[model samples]
Target: MKEYKPSFLFRNAHVNTCFPTFFRKVEIEYRRQRVLLRKDDFLDFDWVEKGNSKIIVLCHGLEGSSQSHYIKAFSRYFSERSWDVLALNYRSCSKEPNPSPFFYVAGKGDEIATALKLTSEYQEVVLIGFSLGANKVLDYLGKEEKIPKNVKMGVAVSPPCDLKESSLLFSKGWNRIYEQYFLKQLKRKVIEKEKKYPNILKEIGISIEKVQKATSLVEFDHLVTSQLAGCSDAYDYYEKNSSLFHLRKIHHPTLILTALDDPMMSEHCYPREEVKNNVWLHLETPQYGGHISYASFEKEYWLEKFVFETVNQFQNRK
Candidate 1:
C-alpha cells in the first residue's frame, strides 16, 4: 500500500475553521427543496443549481438524505468551481414523506438512472456517490447499455460494493451499532410503507416491532425491504444488486475512494485489482475517513479538499 501524503495538517485547520460555514451553506441550499420525478412516486431529488455545464449529480447512502454532511460539503466544493451540483434525495429521504409504497436499496440505481435522464440537457455529466449511492452509480455506468456520451466521469466514496460482505460485517460486535442504527431507520420506513399500503403490508406480515427488533440486514431485507421493493428474497436481491460484479464494465473516467477504517463495510470487500487495467478507474484507499467522516483535524479535513481538488483536476483534464 502506497503511503498517503499527509495533506491533513493544513487542510484540517481550514476545514475545522470553515466547516460550520460550509455546513450552513449546504443547509440553505438543501433545506426542504424537492425535485419530483415522473417515473416513480419513490423518486425525487434535492437540488442546488449553480453553473450550467459539467454537472455533478450526488447520490447519498442508505437512509441518508441529500442533505448529508458529505453531500453538502461536495455541493459547496463543486458549486464554487461553477459546476452545477444536484444533491439527489433517494426515496423517503427528502423530509417530505414519499407518496409511494416502496423505498430504495443499495445498487438499485433507479433514482440514479432517473436523475441522469432528467439531466440529459447537460453537456458534461459527472456522477458522484457516497457509500451505497456510490455502488449504485458504479453499477449503473458499468451496464452493457453504453453509458451516455454526456456522462464524462464518475466518483465513488467508501462504496460497499459487495452486499454479502457488508451484511456480514454488520453482524460483528462493534459493527452491530451501525446495523442497529440502520435497522431503526429501516423499521421506521417500513412502518411508513405499511401505513401507505396496508394491504401489501398485511400480505408481507410486516410488523413495526418485529422489523424494529431485526438484527441482521438479511433479516430486515427478507422480511420487509425485499417485499416492499417487489423482490423475491434477500439473497436474490443481493445477487442482483451488489456492484462488485460490475466493476469490469465501468468504461467512464471513474475514481473510487475508500478508507480502510470504514466501520460499515468489511476489509475483504475492497477489490483493488478488479479494475487495474481500466484506464479510467482510479482507486484510492486512505487509512482514515470512517465512512466519509474524513475529519482529520480538531475541525478541518484535507479529505474534502482532496475530493474537490481531484475532481477539479479531472474535470480540467477532460
Candidate 2:
C-alpha cells in the first residue's frame, strides 16, 4: 500500500481511532439536564441553558435527546455567545414515557409552540433542529398560526425534507446502517410503549417481537409506529407530515444544511430552485458529512462554524 496520509488515516480509522475517540469525547463533554415542561402529567422537555442574550430552542432527532452530541456542542457554542438554549426531547425521549396518549411528530408543532411560548417570554428566539427534529421545525414554521413575536430565525441540519425520498434512501446499501439503527431504537420504544399500554398493542394486533424483527424503517412504521400513534398508515403519516410540501410557506430566515453523501437522505432531497424569494432560505450542500457527521481537521467543524456564524449573522441583522 502507498504511504497512508494522516488525514486519510484519521478518516478511515476503526477501533479507538480518531473518529471513535472524537465521538466518545463528544458524548462525554456535552452535559444535558432533564426538565419538565408541564407540571402535573403532560409532556416534558429536557433542556440545557447556556450564555445569556436570546433564547435558542434546539430540537433533537428521532429517538434522540438533549444529551445528543450535536445538542451539547451547539448549546455550548451558543451559551458562550450569550445565547440561551433549550433542547426539547420529543414525547417519550427524555427518560420516562410521556403521560399523554399522543407523542410528537414532524407535523405536531403544538409541543414546540408550547415550549417556545415559555422560552420566548424573556428573549428573542431562534429554532435549530437536526434530522427528524429539523423536519418538525420546518413544519412548525410553515404553519399559519401566529408564532411567538420573538422568534427571529431558524436552522435545520441534515433535515429529511422529503419523507418519501428519505424512506427510500434508507432502504439502500450502506444507508441500511442508519435505517437499522433507527429501527432498533424505534422498535425498542414501541415495545416499551406496549408494556405501558398492553391494550393498545393488542388493539393494533402487533407483537413486540415482530417490531424487533422489522427490517426497514417503513415496515416498522407501517406495523407499529403509525398505529400506536393513531395515524391511518405510514403513507398517511408521511404524506401529511412531510416538511417538503410546506417549504413554500416558510416565512423566516432559515438555513438548511445537507450533505450529498448523507445516507439517510437522497440527493433529490436537496432542492436548489424550490427556494422561494420571500423566504430567506440558504441551502448548503457539502460533498461529505454522512448524515449529521461533521468531522474536520480543526477543533470546529464546517457545520458547527456554519450554524453558529449563520445564526449570529441573522440575529445581528435584526
Per-residue CA lDDT of candidate 1, range 1-318, in tens? 334443454234234323443443333375344455544365666666765777888988888877677787777777767787777887778765566656777874578777777778889888888889988888887764856789888889888888878887788877776678778887877777667666545664666667777777889988776676667878778777888888887788888888766777676558787867667688888765566656643333455577767877877885
Q: Which stretches of candidate 1 lie over 4 Å from their true place?
A: 1-26, 31-42, 144-146, 204-209, 297-300
| Residue 303 of model 1, lDDT score | 57
Model 2 pairs whose backbones collide: 51-79, 52-82, 53-82
Task: Report RMSD (Å) for each prediction in the order shown.
Answer: 4.3, 4.7
Score candidate 1 by lDDT: 0.72
Summed backbone clashes in each candidate are 4, 3
Model 2 agreement with the true structure over 37-119: per-residue lDDT tens digits = 56523555655455465878888888777777777777766676777777777777777766444456766456678777668
Give Cα-based local distance difference scores for all models. Answer: 0.72, 0.70
Worst lDDT window (10 residues) for model 1? Answer: 10-19
Index of the highest-lDDT prediction: 1
